[model samples]
Target: MSRLAIAAAAGLAALALGTAGASAQTVVSKIKDRGYVVCSGSQGVPGLSRPDEQGVWRGFDTDICRAFAVAILGDREKIRFVPLNAAQRLPAVQTGEIDFLSRTSTITYSRDTAVRFVAITLYDNDGLLVRKASNITDKKQLDGLTVCLQGGGSLTEKAVLETEEEFGIEMKKVYFDATIQARDAYFAGRCDSYVTDGTAAAGQRATVAKNPAEHDIIVIGKGTEPNGVAIAYGDDQLFNVVRWTFNALLWAESKGITQANIDEKLASGDAEISRVLGQEAGFGKAIGLDDKWAYNVIKQVGNYAEIWDRNLGANSPLKVPRGMNALYRDGGVNFPFPWD
Candidate 1:
């Protein structure tokens, strides 16, 4: 062949290879190549995502990570939890250091556009936690009181400033690195109040102190905030996997489904149950996952209510009552998207 003809042939071969590569490449493809999904969790937040003495990870955030793992890898243990600090969480997801982040991250406009949050696994609101002895029942009572907060973050700092301005409350902001330290400072009388998410306040109160109830921690005011998991932007397939996994959890809970009842439901041959478990027609194919992806999540990680009650229930240290987090059927805001 002539030199020009040879060059043209090579270009055609390269074009074919590029097309084939593009066709094969997908979020699930890359995730499988890595062997395990990289999940970002907190460095140490007791009931959210913290390591136990035996190095086993548990809590609501950990469960969220496990749910994603089961959805993709068909095993809850097929994830490596990357414990991240508050500042490192968003950066880690943005840089692709982790496949998904379950680190009690709030879904803010900036983060959604920048880092891309999937479905909100947990919905949370900001509230103040004040020591009962301070005689603070409401925001007005916080006037002239020193409130300890996790400093340097634009979100928390702005919330504190807004609280001060809106409520006409004078608050001295004492910065701390972690909630544990802040809670200690508040208990030790270094600060009169601790301002954080209501869920976090409950967790801190439960984990620290000899008897959590002995020190009356009051939730002063609630703010409108949506907290959830975050993943990288532009990967629609991965986003669908994450979003559907969360919805599956809520859907299962709404339908009175549990790990124990899952097998029974599958065997019962109910059309809705069959569709969810992927025993009939599978919905996972639409999301680029195995037919039983949702089944794996429910079987391994349980549902939304199960996760919440396990971590923040009365028996758990946090003892957080399911207020706004209750299912929509129970008159709360938690409504699962339709599976069909």
Candidate 2:
């Protein structure tokens, strides 16, 4: 063959390969073209994903979604929050109804294999909520008792059932649509126990009953689950975007970086923080985002600790301690993957 013909054939092959690479990297490009990120959250859990009196979605889960928007889209407001129930969360992500689900979903082997968990933002555990007057302190005392549960294939129910068998007890299940309903039934003595996550149990108990202190909704038994956010499986581009976005938040918190300190730190050129925030090194570019992706997230949404403190800390009505949610430095299991 002529040399010119050979060179032309090689150029065509290179062009075909470039097209394939572009198609493989379509997730980020598609999201940017859409102009917004659709995020799934819960309807109304006071400190988790409820709308305030001003009609704005605010909570730990909501903050995570907004952070993703800031990272990928560079605008915290460039997100649409779709409130989904426990059952709807997985299907929505799988069907592409939303880009991601930041609802308080527990990551499990079944869920991780079925749906995709981008990152574990929060570590949660199951606990029992009972009226102080009921005097049910331990799981052993609940044999043959009625328990209020949110019963539409809830993992919380499964966790309770597993615990019941482990403790050699039997409890009746009374189904309720929402935690509020179940809490009311428990407080009114309609059921003997309320089974849910420790944070959720505390949030529900504090909402009703004049003084939460008057009701002894203790966290009985060890936590049976780990909660986190969900993304669609098999989308490597989107998964990395979501995963590293979460890691950036946790890393910032671990390094004692806050929204207030982000600007000064970026200007000061701290090597570690700058690299993570994409100020000194273009880490976001490696992850299919602009260099300022992490900076935008920290500036707009704050870090993981800030979100936890604002929604579930001592100042908030939930008043739950960090416990296992604290950073590794503070004796908790929240360790961040190295940005490098």
Candidate 3:
């Protein structure tokens, strides 16, 4: 065959392979057919992902799952949260056991290779929680103190070590198989402090402590933890849907759009607002859903601020400060990707 003919044949072959690659990622379609999304969670971590008294999951992580459900199915009530331990979190996503993970997992180099991180939903820090009587406000106070932490080379272990190194101090670490064991031991005075991610520490103090007022969350390393939404790799379509749903939440917050004001915003004449609200944009169609996907998220599950306040801030038992989790405009770290 002539040179041009050979080139044309090669192009056709490439197109065929690309088409097959695209067709293989059907997570979105499967979710649509199933009527809901399956999100992975811990057994119960107050202010994060934990079942309430009525057996319904409620927390920041669970609310993130709800946002995904709203964006994809347009139903705030349609979602299933399955409890998975630390060992099971990543594998479940890789094996299709869970549709995604919102268990306040920090984005790490090794984890990024195994699954696609949809977005940084929370900016957390590893911390040391001590009794109010201890008055351990400075890292200098941590030197030589025994800390109760989860063992097995987990992030908690790493956080404790990082604190020791950063503060120019050395700590005695007592590691346990499960966080509860470590926390229970800490409450029992087995150690001087409890080491874990800041949020988990806050949760433990709020829900497990005999007197929540006796404990305090002393943030460890500078906000090094970028907790993310994790989904399986090899499925860009599914990844984009989850990612943009998170973005929609942040974007809504950036524009001061709340659950109570979304309908009014939707009726506004602003073009970008209209597009983001799905009144004039094809965002949903571009991601293989109703144009009202973002609209549904804000309207039903609420914007990021609403979820945070209700789950981790003013409205919840934890009442943790927004800190790094707040929107950038509000003097925090969160910001939305451009909708256009």
Q: Tell me, by TM-score, which candidate is best.
A: 3
Query: Residues 1-340, candidate 1, lDDT per residue (tens digit)?
Result: 9999999999999998975575366556787877788888786777888888999898888898899888888988888888887778888888889988888788887778889887776666665666666775677777788888787573656667777787887788899887557767877879887777767767877886566765555444435667787888767678788888898999999888898889987888678888878876556777768889888888888888889888887658787788778887797789888865
**Candidate numbers sorted by lDDT from highest down:** 3, 2, 1
Candidate 1, residue 197: lDDT: 70
Cα lDDT tens digits for candidate 2, 1-340: 9999999999999998986687555656777989998988686776778778888888788888889889888998898888887777889988889888888788877788878887887777777876667687676887888899887877778777777888998888999886667767887889878877777777766775577886655555545456777877767778788888888888888777899988787777678876776655556666778888888898899988888988888767999888888998898888889865
lDDT of model 1, residue 266: 83
TM-score of 3: 0.91
Per-residue lDDT tens digits for candidate 3, residues 1-340, read 9999999999999998995677555787888889888998787788898888899998999999988888888897889988987777899999999998999788898999998898899888787889889888677889999999888777778877777788899998887877777888999999999988888888899889999998888877654789889988888778888889999998999988999999898788878889878876566777788988888899998889899999888988888899878888788888999976
lDDT of model number 2: 0.80
Instruction: Report the poorest 10 consecutive residues by lDDT, candidate 3.
Output: 19-28
If candidate 2 were superposed on the true structure by all CA atoms, what would the RMSD be?
3.8
Cα TM-score of candidate 1: 0.88
lDDT of 3 at 173: 86
Q: In candidate 2, which residue ranges exceed 4 Å CA deviation? A: 1-27, 177-181, 187-189, 220-223
